[model samples]
Target chain A: MQNVTKSKWWQTMILKTIAMVLIGFIVFGPLMGTLLWSFAEKWFWPAAFPQELGLKYWKIAFTGQSPVLDSMAISITIALIVVVLATLISVPAGYALARFNLPWKRILLVLFLMPQAFPQLPVFINMTSIFYRYDLVGTVPGVIAVHLVISLVYSVWITTAAFKSIPVTLEEAARNLGASRLRVFFRITLPLATPGLIASSIFVFITSFDEFTGTFFIGAPFIQTLPTLMYTASMGYNMQYASVIAILLTIPALLFMLVLEKFLKAEYISGLGV
Target chain B: MQPRAAVKRPSIRVSDGQREAVSGLVLVLPALLVLCVLYIYPLCASIAGSFVSDEGIGLHNFAKAFTLYGTDILFTIGITIITLVLVFVVAVLTASFLRFRNWPFLNFVYRLPLFIPYLIAGHTMRVFLAPHGILNILISRVTGLSDLPGLAFSWIGLVITFVWKQFPLATLLILGAFQSVEDSYIEASLNLGGNKVRAVWEILLPICRPTVLVAMVLTFVSTIGCLTIPLLIGPSKPVMLPIDMAFRINYMGDWGVANALGVISYLIVIALSMYYLSYTVKKEDA
Candidate 1:
């Protein structure tokens, strides 16, 4: 019995080690390869590592000749616009959903969520006609408008969750103490909900930044974002340039994820259900 | 506690209620307007566009779309199903292990993919799975298989990329469900002569069914509609639905057929949405 138990312990330990190693490979293998490939000058097969490394691709990525720098700027500009517009629009709607007893409240909430329910392909394809009519196709604002359709859902849901989590009694108490509604909101409610609001904004920003299909459909030819640039490079077999672009695209998202780490658990659970 | 106060407050509350209603409408109006113009209008136009063609408003375009892109639609569905199964299995195992086991780094590793975008993930897959990629190098070195087939630009690569990008979300969702499971149930199962696997299967799985279902539906819908992974890694022939629809527009300039395909995709999403809605409503009622 002692020997059997000891063998079982060894078996479990080995299994766990293998599992951990496999998980590590799955998570980090591609990421590491991409990082190495970005800097590699001659990373041929049948060798364990890159034969030589240089900053040629990185230089190209940073130079004005390549679309990388411009794409990054465009992506950031569009994402910021999306974040600002989504926040401005969603905050009031979220506040209403949280504080008021509106008619067909559930339906309204579902309507906000409906944008995400369908595939973006259909919507963007359909919008291409209207955008063409309005002369908005291949324009940054047009892409931003399309992105708003998806980003608004998350922004509203998350911001509503943020508002819902705030205690009503605090607002009422402030009101009773002769504080104006605006003052109560700005002073009392806004400060408390700042973290969640920031988190939701980050979500909106990332969603917009990572938006590919809509941007590709609407912003092609005239507007080139990082994702669209990456797609073009990858399709054109410019692996080295694509790697650099991928890394650039990942940096902001990674930073935001770290910032979102604290608030994400609560926000995802509470906000996503509806 | 407030019968007298309630009666006394009604007169003051009447005007307050009206003011509140007005403010509520005002608050939601901007968002409603944006949704109406950006979202509702586009949706209506899409539906309308799908039904209209050269021959007038009919199902002709849809029939063409079905006959033309049927394989692509089926392929998309097949990939979604496969990805869903793989994601579900990986998510459940990883989530349960992280919950019950004392693997601290597992949680961090599982979540790392969440930070990576689909575009980057696809790039990573291509980098690692190419003919001269690191994966082939390792396989050749270890297994002595010199002529191993390249996995890049294939359905397998697409699956790998999709699973890598999406399974983190599934794990997180399932982990949330796992967090709500009572420890005592597992202990009780153990005390009743069940092993850990049996305990999970008997006690935990049933409790997590709803969350698991949600995760599956979410993964299915997202994967079926996804364009980046399949675009980057998927083969040219037997393309996914999104790519097929795109080709219809970009190459063929056939808006009618493309819109028809879009409507078909929308119907699939609507079906899933109905299921999700009913499930959430039932959960609420319960």
Candidate 2:
């Protein structure tokens, strides 16, 4: 028994060490590589580390030389607009789905979820073709419209959960007290769900901020976002420039990660893959 | 709990039901309208466009797509399957580790990718998997071998990128599931002299089967629609379906073939998603 336990313990030690090393490398290795490349003044073949490291690429990246700054501006602008629009559309829909007696409730919920559940590339491709008819293709508004598809997943689903979580009786009591229905909702439901609504908004912001597929399909070759800029730079073999912007984009994600654990419900994350 | 207002307006309550129904429709209308315009129309257009071909309204586009890009479809299937299996294994192990241990840093590290966009995942792999890149450098140093070729621009690299991208979410889901599994169940196996792996396989996994299924579904379908990882790390020749669709549309001006490929991709999603959709619906109803 002692021998068996001893050998088993040793085996576990070896296995755990291997697992740690592999996981650590898998998760962090690429990040380290990107960080090194961003500052690699003169990395060459056969050198495991950069021979020279400085912020040369970083300097060029922010200046008029690179498309980084403009892409950042456009990315933020579209995300903010999508956040506002998606929220307006979703809050009522979410509340109706959650607290009201709606017709075809299940089907409506399913329809709202179709964007997250389906293969979006096909939809985006067809959108590009359809948008051409209205001359919306390759425009900033076109990109924002495309972004609404994915951002709605966050806004609608999370808001539904938010409103669903608020006790229905609070709204009922306000209504019973002779408050108008609109007043009841605004005073009770909206304020009560505000924290979750804010979280939902942040989730929407991050998703729109990082949206790639639709932007690629609808806004590419004309309007450039950080994602498209990364694609072009990487394709053109400007690894350092791509790395710098990649790190820039990663900042919001990194910040949210600290707080994500609180909002990181399994249901919410199920909508992640765009 | 029974604090109803004694002087409640029964008349208002009766009319309130009717008003509620109207408001429900009005409130849900915007999202449904956006869904109609954004998703339903585009979807109908894609399906309709797929039927338009050189031979006129049939399987010509599909036939051409299969003849031209059959290998790419197979490649995509290969990548998805391989990534699914790897992601399942890794997720289970990571979730198991989290279940058995209390390492906060490791937990944080494992879940970080869940917060990231697929763009970063793709870009990170692009930089790391490039020829003469860090992965190669490390391999050469470890094994005393040099001149390793890049896996960055290949199907293997695509799989790696996806596993990295998809596993964190799977791990998050699986870990959440594992957290709810009664510790006494796992403890019973450990008390029987069973190892952690055995306990996981015999006790934990069976209990968490539904979550495992959900995680697998998420991992499987994710690779199908993905464009960035494939674009960044995939080989130029015989690319993934999204890449092929983009090329056909952007370069060849062949919306028929592109939309055909789109339909084919959607069919894959539909096949897998029927279960997922029903599952989600059931959960929603619950």
Candidate 3:
């Protein structure tokens, strides 16, 4: 029995070590490759690594010559706008859904979720007429509004969980204590659910920031976001420029996720029973 | 508990009329107005345009998109299947590996691509797999081969890139699903003398069946409507549906046909999403 147990333990450790190496390869392979390529000078066929490496492409991408700056700026603006608008729209709606026994809740849930499942291509094509009619195409706000359709759904889903996590007894106690409804809300409820709200907003921001399909359809030739610029740079066969901007755009998202790491527990978001 | 907390204070009361009006305006009015102006109206216009014939009301646009040059449809279907299969197989393996392993840094590394946008992923691969690119160089070095294989600008490369970009998300979802399986079940399987492969197949796989289905459905819908990867690496003969639609609307200025294609893609996506949404909702209720 001792021999069997000892051997089994060793076998399990070996299996674990092998699994670790496999995961390491899977994760870092593409990431390190991209990072290396970003700094390569004339990295083309026949060279395993770049013969000469420099900061030339990074300089161009940061300067006015590269479209990345404008694209990044516009993407940030649009994402923030989407986050705020979605919060405004979803907060009360999510609260009602979570707290009240409202009629048509199921139907409303379906309606709210309908846009998420539907492909953005159809919506983009459909919005062309709106663009022409209202002269809304190619504008940053126009792109932002189109993005809100999806971002709003994300905000609603995440915020619903946030709101549901707030206990009912707290609200009832505040009501009974002669505190006005507004005081109870802004003080107790909002502060308590701030983490969830922030997490949901982060999700909305990421969704809008990384949105490519709608931005391509609406913002082409006019308003450039980071993804759109990345597309154009790559389309022109400027791989160096694309890589530089790709790295630049990825930085902000990674930073945002890191900052919110303490609050936005993956289990919390997933455990909302969604 | 505070003695005052149990009492329902009637001092801070609002009139019922004001309450009703505020509720109506707050809950229903803005949403109804926005839907009318933004979503409902545009969709109606697009639907109408799709049916308008050269002369009058007809299904010419739909017919053209549906039947005219069926190659686009075939290409889209083919690429979608390829992407789905590649992503699923790779994701399952990666997720399984992560579950059995305790490499925190490796887990973090696996998620790096999730932060990178699709365009960046596609473009980086486009460069690295160029004829004179790293992939070909490595190939030549290993085999002592002279001719550089420029496989980057092909269907295989596109599928590979798609799998790389998407597998992380699939792995994460499946990993979550795997974690939900009770440890007792695995212990019981081991006690019964089941081997690792058999235990995984019979115990873990069956338990994670729903999540696996969810992952597959998500992959199918996502790949079927891809615009970036196909545009980047795919050839000219067989264009994916999204690329073809973009060409018609943007390049050729054929809005009606583009909208028709869009509607078809939308229907497929919506059907899949509804299946997932309803399934989850039902599962939660049960």
Q: Which candidate is the best by lDDT?
A: 2
Query: Candidate 3: which stretches are off by over 4 Å?
Result: A1-25, A64-66, B1-25, B28-37, B193-210, B270-286
Which 10 consecutive residues of model 3 chain A have the lowest summed lDDT? A265-274
- Native contacts recovered, each model: 0.66, 0.72, 0.33
- Residue A122 shift from truth in candidate 3, angstroms: 1.8
Q: Extract clashing residue pairs from model 2.
A: none
Model 2: fraction of native contacts: 0.72
Tens digit per residue, CA lDDT, model 1, A33-55: 88988898887768788889999
Report lDDT (CA) for all predictions: 0.82, 0.83, 0.73
Full-model lDDT, candidate 1: 0.82
Local accuracy of candidate 3 as per-residue lDDT tens digits, B106-179: 66777767776677677767766667666667678999897766767777777777787888877888888877
**Pairs that clash in candidate 3:** A44-B132, A45-B132
- Can you list the residue pairs that collide in candidate 1? none
| Stretch of 10 with least lDDT, candidate 2 chain B | B6-15
lDDT of 3 by residue, A92-123 (tens): 77765665555565666556665554455666
| Residue B20, model 2, lDDT | 78
